[model samples]
Target: MASFQKDFKIWVMDHLPGSALLSEPLSLEPIAGDAGFRSYFRLNTQIPLLAVYSPPQEENNLAFVRVSHHFSSGKIKVPKIFAVNFEKGFMLLQDFGTELLQPLLNLDTLPQYYDLAEELLLDLQLLHPGDSIFPNYGKPQLIAELQLFQKWFVDKLLMLDLSQRDLSILDDLFELLIGNAMEQPIVIVHRDYHSRNLIVHNNQIGVIDYQDAVVGPITYDLVSLLKDCYLSWPEEIVRQRALSYKSRAVSKGLMREIKDQKFMKWFDWMGLQRHIKVMGIFARLSIRDNKESYLSELPRVVNYVLSTTFNYSELKPFNQWFSERICVCLPRYPWYSGD
Candidate 1:
C-alpha cells in the first residue's frame, strides 16, 4: 500500500503540481472496465478522487488523450483531462463520481435519458466522412472483429472444434454482414456507447471509455444504446424509440438522404455486427483474462445478434445456424430471462 501511495503521489505531483495536496493518496482499487483495457484507482483525497492508471505499454494511451480532447472540444461530455504524461502513459482526470446510467436508468427516467442519448447521437452524426481524427470502421475491420467471435467464442472458448466447412460458412456469413455495414452512412462511432459507459452527473449524461472511437456507421452507437447487452428492453419499444430518434436526426438535417426503412436497416445491421464482436470480447475476457462478470451478459448479446439477423431474408442462413447450433448448445443466462 505504501509503495503504491509513493508511486501514485509522485505520478500526480509530476503531472498535476497541486494534486497531491488535495488529500493523501489512498490504496489503488481495480475499476470495472470494458474488455480491451484494465484500470486501477488512487483514492483517499478530500475531493473523493480516483485516477485511471492504464499502462502505456498495454494500451494506446495517446489515442485516449487525443480522442478525449477532440470529443471535449466538440461539446461531448467526457471527463476533462487535468494532466497527462504520454511517455510515462499516465493521466490525471477529473473524477466523475460513480453514477452510471445502468443503475440510474429506471422506468420513470428512461424516456428522459433516451432523449439525451438521441441528442448526443445527433451531434455524433454531425462528424463528416473524411474526418482524419478518427480511425476508419470499414469492411475489413468489421470482418476482423466478427472473425474474433468465430475464433475465440465459437472455437476456443466453447471448445466447439468446428470443422473446416463450418468455419468457412461462418466466415462467409461474417463477410456478408461486414458488407452490409459498409454500405451504410458513416459517422463518428463511440464504439461502446452503452448504459455502463455513461456517467450520470448533475442530471446530465457524460460519456467515458471512448478511447477507441472510430469512424463507422451512424447507427452503430445508436444500436449499442438501444440493444444494450447489460440491459434489455422490449423489441417494439426499442424500434419505436429508434424511429423517433431517426426522425429527430432527419429533422436536424444530419441524415437528410436516407429514408426511415433504410435507416432501420443500418441500425439492425450495425447492431448485428456489434453484438457479434461483443460476444467474442466477453468470452475472451472470461476464458483468457479470468473475468467472469461479463459471462452473465453473453445471452443478451446473443439475443441481439439473433434478433437482428432474423430481420432480413438474406441473413436466414446465419439465423438458422445460430438457432440450431449456438443457441441450443448454450442456454440463456438467468439475467436474460425476465426481459
Candidate 2:
C-alpha cells in the first residue's frame, strides 16, 4: 500500500474501531475539491462515508471539527463528523452526496431553494454562540479584505501601476465600504453561503465549507446568498427576496425595524466588500495554487462591483477608475470581456 493510504487506513482503524466500515473492504474515489486545501474522497464501504484529507499545514482540521460540532448541536444541517485524526489531518464524515445546490439552481427553482436557505440562515443567526469560538469580522479584518483587490487582483493579476491619485481614491473607497459593513446588525456569518458550498440532499439543504463562520454584519451572509459570486439573479428578484428575509427577521426579533432603503444599502455595500475580497482571492488561487478555473469567474464578480457602485454617487470615483483603467483592459484577458 502507498504510505499515505496506509497511514489513512491505520488512523481510521484506531479512531473508528467499532464502526461498520471495518467489517467490509474499503474503497475510495476522488471527489472534486473546494477553494480550500482539503481534498475529499468517497469511502465506498458497507456504510457510505467521506474521507477528507486536509493538509495539516494548510487547513485547520481542528477548527472544522469544533465548528461542525457546534453547528450540529444547534440543529444546523451540516455534515456529521464520524471520526477525525487531527495529527494526520484525516477525517471520516457523513456522505452528503454529489448534489451541490449550484447545478440545480435556475429561475424556476430559485425561490423555493432560496426560501429554505434563508430559513437555515436565520436558524444559525438565532443560535447563541455560548461556548463556540468564532472570529470577529471587525473593521481591521474588513479593511484588510478590501485591500486584497488592490494587492492581488489589481497589482498582481492585472499588473496595474496605480498613480498617487488612484491609490488615494482606492483607500477612501475601502474605508467607505468598511463603514457600511460595520454599521449593520452583527450575527453569525457563514462566510461562503453561495450555492456551490450548499448541498441539496433528500429535499433538504445541507451546508458545507463552514469552518470560516464568524460574528459579523448580518447582511454579509444574506448578500453572499442572494447576490452570489457564482450566479446572478434579476435585480428585482434580489431585492424582493432580501425584503422577504428582512420581514421574517424583524418578526422574529432577529433584526430591528430598519428602512428598506437602509437594508438594501447594507446588502449592496456588503456585497462589494465580499466581491472585492473574492477578486483578490480568486487571483491568488490561480497564480499561487494553479487553480486556473477561478479566473473565469472574475468578470461576473467585476460586473457585480460595477453594477452596485454605479448606483451610488459616493462610489462614482471608484466606478470611473474601473471604467477608465480596468474595464478597457479586461478584453485582453481570455477570462474577462467586460460583459
Candidate 3:
C-alpha cells in the first residue's frame, strides 16, 4: 500500500480505539473518490463509517466541518461526523452507503424522488449564510470560473484558434451570464448540488461533497440538480420542474414573484454559466488530474450548452461560432459524440 493510505489507516486507528476497525484492519476498503483530491475508505464495522483523507492544502476541511454542522442544524440530511483532525486532514464520518440518487432515477420514480430533492433544496436555501463560514460568489469568483473554460477546455483540451472578435463575443456572453446570476436572491449554495453527489440514505436524500458552499444565486443549485452534467433529461421537463421549485421559493419567500419567462431566462442563463465552468473543470480533471472519465461526459454538457445557445437571440453569434468551430473540433475527440 502507498504511504499515504497506510498513514490514514493509522490515523483512523488513533481516533477510534474500541471500534472493530482496529481488530479487523483489513475491513477498510477503498471507495471511489470525487473530482477532488480527497480519498475515502469504507469501514465495515458493526456500524459502517467512512475514513476520509482530505488534503488541507487542496480542500477546505475547516469549511466542511463548519458547513456540515450548519446544514445539520437546519435539518438537512448530511453525514454525521464522528471524528476529525484538521492538522492531518482525517475524519471518520457516517457512511451513507453506496446508493447514489443518479442510478435510482427513472421515469416511474422520477417525480417522487425529484420532489423530495426539491423540498430538501428549499431547506438548504433557507439556511442563513451568516450562521456559517459562507463566502460571496461574486464577480471575481464567477469570472475565474468562466476563465476555466478558456484555459482548460478551449486551450488545453481543444486548442481552438480564435480571432479578437470571437474573444470579444465570448466576453459579452460571460458578462451577461454573470450579471444574471448577480441579480438573483442570495442564499447558501451547495456549489455542487447534482445527482451523483446525492445519496439515497434511509429513505431521504443525503447530500455530500458540499465543502464549497457559498452565498450566491438562488437558482444556482436548482439548475445544477435539474440539468445535471452526468445525467440527460428532457429540457422542457427540466424547465417544468424548475418552475415547480420557483413556486415553492416564492411561497417560502426565497424569491419574489416573477413572470415565467423572466424566471426561465434566469434559470437557463444560470445553467450556461455552470455548464461553461464545468467544461473547464472536466477538461482540467482529464489533463491535469489524470481522470479521463470526465471527458466521456462532455457530449451531454455540450448538448446543454447548445440547447441554451440556440434558445437565446443574444447568443446567436457564439452559437454559430460553437457550431462552426467548437462543434467541428469536438468530433475529432474520441470521447465526444455528435450530441
> Which one is best on lDDT?
3
**Looking at candidate 2, what is the lDDT of residue 329?**
81
User: Cα deviation of 216 in candidate 2 (Å)?
Assistant: 0.3
lDDT agreement with native, every candidate: 0.77, 0.88, 0.90
Q: After superposition, how far is residue 146 of candidate 1 from its true place, in Å?
A: 0.5
Roughly what TM-score does model 2 have, to 2 decimal places? 0.96
Q: The CA-based lDDT of model 3 is what?
A: 0.90
Q: Which whole-number lDDT from 0 to 100 does residue 126 have in model 2?
A: 90
What lDDT tens digits, residue by residue, belong to model 3 across residues 1-339?
Answer: 489777877787776635544445445788999999999988867777899989888999999999999999899999989899899899999999999999999878889889989999999999877653898999999999999998999999999777898789889999999999999989889999999999999899999999999999998999999999999788778989989889999999988999989999999999999999999999999999999999999999999999999999988878998888788888877899634
Show pairs that collide, candidate 1.
none
Locate the minimum summed-lDDT window of 10 residues in model 2.
Answer: 15-24
The full ranking of all candidates by TM-score, starting with the best, is 2, 3, 1
Deviation in Å, model 1, residue 7 alpha carbon: 2.2
Residue 283 C-alpha lDDT in model 3: 99
Model 1 residue 44 lDDT score: 55
